[model samples]
Target: MPWFPEFSSAAELARREIRIAGQADPVAQYFTALNEGRTDALEVVWPGEVVIHDPRAGVVRGHRELRTFVQDNRSWLAEHEARIEIMASTVVGPRAVVELLAHVRYDGREVPWPMAVVAESPDDRSVVFRTYCSQWPVDGRRHVRPPVFEPGHAEPGDVVGRHLGALASGDTESILKTFVPDGYVAEPIGPDYIHRGADELRSFYTGTFSEGGGIGLQNCTMIDDGVRCALEYNLIAWGTHAVPPQAGIAVYERSPDGLLAAVRIYDDVEPPDSR
Candidate 1:
């Protein structure tokens, strides 16, 4: 016999609606929960297996730690009178990268702190955030941080991987070989410091090698799409000075020929023991 399907009760329907709303854009919900200091809402969007790798708080897993991290972060922002201004956002596949400027009133002066967050959702039930930023803007000094990820080697087929290998080798020709003829590299600090083309890149790489023959990268996490790769690394050593390791993030966009077309970096790491 033909039969009618059972319908959900009003209360059940309401709960389903809430779940659908929460899943609309989990990342947006994440930021909203942080800004509002709403741990309940955060728990709704963050699965039990959620993880956060933060510079200040280190790595936090599970719901309890995440709740504490969120609350503490909110308190810290409030204490510093900090406001986040979103500069840009780019999403590729299941990964999203957001660039923002943290405006904080410190020492009776307002400072713009550059920051970036990479959000990755492996499935509907899991997500992770890797935040990158310089600590100088907040405390007026560099705060050393422990490694967030484990030491790992890059895949051989990746162009950015080859570039990192060249940097570590301190081979100028090898480094340049990974870049296109008209490629450009943007430093962490100023906008006017961009090095473009072969001659300019040669000079920039030379200077970098002069300061530190090779950079020791630790705890690296790379997010690579077909055309671009976003890398987060800890600069453990540079040159002769074995200074405290600092965090840095860089985005490398590749040309059609598989060479690096542009490299953009974000960090506050100065030369070894510049302080």
Candidate 2:
């Protein structure tokens, strides 16, 4: 038996319940009952009013339609041994989206099919239960696909390395060049404090780097969308134990000049404050 942990938020709790149970799909029995046309076995864990966001059909407003969708999928189970293989799941606010790739095994054939489901809690607190039995097939052959990476996404390690190199060389101008001019650090629980222009950003880096100590960027993580970029790096200033392990995220937006438009930093932000 898997442990179904409860969450403070009702939606999270419900999502957790489904996740824990589906970890190994013990509820295949429940689906077995439904596929066998036993409506009594269709136990709904939904709240009074639940919203279903299906990737194909858009939004389903009530539990009845959701239940009907459940009823509709019963025939597929009769064709193969269905098991829920969760590919990925993300929880945000009072909602969670689950991606499951169902694997089917039957009659000397196997295939895989993908399905996405979204759960929403009416209030911020709600719990849910989910079961699975749909499956397609998984052929024995492997599919090799080309790797996809954004046009210019730099590894956090490389970025940190370059910044450290600039720090070591006392190249304040180079360090400033790395960050978008108007770059601002993503502050926790507060709005960003803009650094205004490149000169200010250069000053900020020059002051921090010139403290006559070995600095390092640790636990660095970088994320980017073609247009904008983000990075979280820890700043450690060595002398006088002056620098704390300040975990901060920098948000960069490009200017028309192809330079950084703004820079902001939330010095008060802490490590655990980030998700």
lDDT of each: 0.73, 0.43
TM-score of 1: 0.74
Most accurate candidate by lDDT: 1
Q: Which lDDT tens digits does candidate 1 get at residues 128-229?
A: 877777676667566665556666554435778788888876777788888999999976543456899989999988878786467777736666667777
TM-score for each of the candidates: 0.74, 0.33
Q: After superposition, how far is residue 28 of candidate 1 from its true place, in Å?
A: 2.8
Q: How many steric clashes between backbone atoms does each model show?
A: 1, 20
Which runs in model 2 stand beyond 4 Å of their true positions? 1-154, 157-170, 179-193, 213-215, 238-246, 256-258, 267-275
Query: lDDT per residue, candidate 2, 1-275, as tens digits?
Result: 23444334676666667544533232342344345644332233333544433322334455566566556556556567777675444444443434455666655655555443334344422333221111112332222111111223335343444554665555777767766545543222222223445776666555554544434444343444433344445554442243445443344444555555543232222222111
Candidate number of the best TM-score: 1
